[model samples]
Target: MQDRSTFHDAATPLPEVAGYRVLRRIADGGMSTVYLARQESLGRDVAIKVMRPEALGDEVSRRRFENEARTIGRLDHPHIVGIHQIGRTADDRPFFVMPHMTRGHLGQRDLAGDEARIREILRALLSALAYAHARGVIHRDVKAENVLFDDADRPLLADFGIALRRGYGSRVTSAGLALGSTAYMAPEQARGEEVDHRADLYAMGVLTWEMLTGRLPFEAQDALSMAVMHAQDPIPRLPPHLRHWQKFIDRSMAKYPLKRHHDAADMLQALERIPYGPQRSFSPRDAAAAGVARMRDLPRGAWIVLGLILAAGLGFGLRHGDDTARGFFRASQPQPAADSMAVGGAAVIDNPDDALLRAAPESEASTLVEDARRQLEQRRLVSPSDDNAYDSLVAVARIAPDHLELPQLSAQLARALATDAVRATKNGDDADARARFERIATLVQATGLADDDLARELRRDTTAALAVRIDAAARRFDREAARKAAALAGVANLDADALGRLRRQAEAIPAVGAVLPGDPARMTVVRSGDGAYALTRRHISRSEYARFAEATGRPATLCRERASVLRVIARRDWTDPGFEQNNADPVVCVSWDDAQAFAQWLGARNGHRYRLPTTVEASGSAAAVGSRAVAEWLLDCEGDCVRRKVRGSSWRRDEDSRARDGGRGYDDVGFRLVREP
Candidate 1:
């Protein structure tokens, strides 16, 4: 096989497949070339995996290719890539279509140290494996390169070219070639031994290690050596920081299959037990160091008391001339009459511990304040360690208790967090934004900074941003965005009246493109030269017309096959126009009379007068809605009422407006309605 890296350097001719237009080659694997193509019938992008012509020459390769298509075609798991269609190209090369995973593969992503993301991918993959194993299928080629992601960044197990059914013999691998990638190959698999689902579990363990440490556990110069190492070498240990997963890795990569996890379900349970947060394991040396550090932090009062006891034990005589010793032990001893020492023209207090305590804390508080300010400048508000600004502030409060700078520092950190929260919100990361907001609230209450009004201002700004998101989503009919915005609003504690209005707007979004009588099509109010009226946002769709036809029992109209010629076809109507269309596509091939009939039927059912938009209304609405693929019928007619006016451009003609026969339907003509005020 040629190097996969050079596959794109050569300009390979695109293969012709029926009902699909191959746009470009996306990927080249050992046995197939995947192309991005548009499925014309569905009008959506799909990936077509065509067997390499050279592979088709080999009977075993041909069988494996066909087997992969048949294997995935029967499986219906969400995490598994599904086969859409299987067919042959113009040159008889076999091809199978699957969803175009636009986000690439797991190998292209960086999952290092992201336990939550890694766990998500692992759970999805394990569930897929479980499903496949129960159905007697084993994905022998489970690797990062085989795991693809969809548009939503969800991991999907793909590439089942070498998948084997439980009962099937190993004919596909009879050529003595190593099947899976050597880096992730199971020990048993590397030894050319008969393997089952447990082999995939071992491979999963290798993948887990790679994701956690950003490197493969075992490395060798060649595939042969790599395979040998998998069979004979001791299981590699995780790094010290990741030692919490040592038990999991040990069992999963056990030398024998029996010592490994019994099944995917059992592995899932083990994964659940693994903690996401870093675990701390202390050694005797570390404990001793901590003890020493604590002892060094003892106050001067404690040391003074120890010194006085020692002096009494030594039978030292007390004298007023011994000013140095007296000053040091003054707080612990009784007050000396008028002989108290005076320094720099100020009388020294008999109890020196009060001054010592205040001096020590003031020095410590100054250092803490400096550290906190530096951390704040570095944006280390709450993470990386106990050395962050938040922790420093807290330490100052504990030591000084009434440090003058504490409130100001707390307020600065709070403002910084508020900035982060707003940034997260703008980036559409509602969960991260919510977490930051909660942290800010905790800081305010902890420091008694509620009187600062920072929290209240942040709440108002965040709520306003979320409200904008809600309205924008409602306008675009994006239910997911609207739901996320609404959820964030709840977290922001938005006022009830405002929240209720936004909720109602989101609830009004249409579930489907079909506009029933009770649920009218989306419209925009247009103020034209004649009057103000509401015009439909888009041209009438086939699904909407289908509803109207079903309810009114209307017959299909004869539609012209082409716009230039009068070649009227009896079978061609809105349902069977020359091209394919989904429900959302504008309904073409409807005559002016047919459109009028539909408007009348809808108006009567909804108790509102509806008619085709006049030329003036459509011209005004076009600036707002933009031109569509089809020309739309208008209420105005030509001389003697023989032709009706059409506005906007059509698929065949890019002209703005034209007059067409009112009784005949053109394939590129549709209509939109105007609702009377």
Candidate 2:
């Protein structure tokens, strides 16, 4: 058999498959090539997997390819990719069509440290596997590459080409080639022994480990070496922060198949029980061990210096009996008998410094405030436990509620957090940005700085950040992100009118894939008798018009320039416009015919219908349209249909609503588009 990598390249022209217009080849595997094509009857995108011509000579490859379509065709589940139809190309090569997953596959996503997203994907895959297992079909290859995501970002298990159904013969594959990925293969599967659904569960375990830690549990130089490692290597431990998931990992990737979860459903249950957040609690012994480990890693010179400091401090406490020394020694002591202290009905591990601060607020307040300032300087805002700025500031507030410097320090910290939020947003880490903003809000309340400058600065920064986030999300057509940003805006106390505008922008993203084509950042969602549609808040700009014109090779028509009366200037078109205007200015001098062409081009490109708004739709938006300095073309025509209706007042003359010849261009005439929902 030929190696899987030795198949046809996408550069080669694809053979026409009946009933589908093949756009391009998306993926190529050992046995087939997947094409992104439009299904003729349904007018929707679908993925068509066609077998390679070379694979036809091999009966085993042929049977496996046919088996994939038949097996998937028999199973019906939302999380599993279903076969729309099975057919053969002109040359008799078998092929199957599936939903076009535009979001790509699991392997392409940056899932590291995104626990919620990882869990969501895992749940979908497990549900799919459970459905398949009940029918006695095991997905032999359950790696990340086989999981695809649809446009809505829902994950679906695909490529059941190498699946093994119960009662199928024990031959895993042809001669020496392994049918599964070595990195995720169970010991039994790696050893060429009989396997069951537990084998699939083991691969799921490997997948879970990879998703959680961003790396595989075991690694080797080659496939055979990796297989050996999977069969014999001890299961690796998760990072200390993710230790809570170790039990799930151990059971899922057990060296022996029998030791793994009994079925996919059982494994999914185990997964659900695992907490999404960190749940590890440290005992005194664990803390001591950690301290010792840190000490061992320290240089000998540092250890001696630490011993001298402790010895000197002890002598000072004994000789002078100073309360500061006493407090220091008290903090150095081990944790109390009770591992955790109850606060506000929640069990939290006691912080020795916090306890000391509460016990002697008068003397410790200044020191705690200084420590907080230092932590803030280091950018250690809310992490590393007893050492972060947040805990230090909170301790100061509790111990000395009336401390003179408390308000200033709290405001500074809030400002720093807001800055971090903006930085995170710029870096495309929206989750971290939101967390920072939430922390700032909580900090203001927790430290009693709500009425101070902290609150004002927070509202200001949040308003600006919300504007950036909402506009960006709308441009990307990410409705969820926009909605979340709107919620954040509400939390920041944005005024009713401004908040409503932002909310409307967020709601319009999915309706049109983005804001209006020309405005770049502003669009209005309008509801009329025809239905809901998105309209550009402004007339199409010069820069936006240039793109359409350049792409379609559209020529500019003569415009009626206003200089010593109106005359059609041969050289004056939208590009020149007979006036000095920037790219941001509304494009003018385009005839009604040109506007229709631009609309058609945009609709075809975005997979959404676009056109000039009807007279009623334009009338409804009369306030916005009349404010602009250009008259816009409307879809309605007058009299013998020789003239198109125009709305809005222009810079030159006031023509609120009138009809003009469709073939001629005017210096003050341009257009806006309505995107159908």
In candidate 2, list every pair of residues with a backbone clash: none
TM-score of each: 0.45, 0.43
Candidate 1's clash total is 0
Each prediction's whole-model lDDT (CA): 0.77, 0.77
Can you give the lDDT of residue 212 in candidate 1? 87
Expressed as tens digits, the lDDT of each residue in 1-677 for candidate 2 is 11122234657987687778988777778888888889774589987888989999988888888878878876777688877668889888899888877777777667888888887788789888998999989888999888888887888888888888766664634334466888889888888777788989999999999898888998889999999999888999998788878989999999987789988877876775565466656699999999989989999999899999999988887887776657666545566759786889976756645565445444788899989889989988988887998888888889898999888888878788877876775455767877887787777667888543345445545555676678666545566778888876665565676588778888777553234544432566655553445777778888888987875668987777435343532467888766788887888889999998887666544444578988777765643333347888999999987899998778778766878888768888888887654
**Best candidate, TM-score-wise?**
1
Q: Give the poorly placed runs of model 1, Cα more than 4 Å off.
A: 1-11, 282-677
Model 1 steric clash pairs: none
lDDT at residue 338 of model 2 (Cα atoms): 92
Per-residue lDDT of model 1, residues 21-112, tens digit only? 99878778778888889988558898899998889888988888888998887676669888766889999999988888878777777888
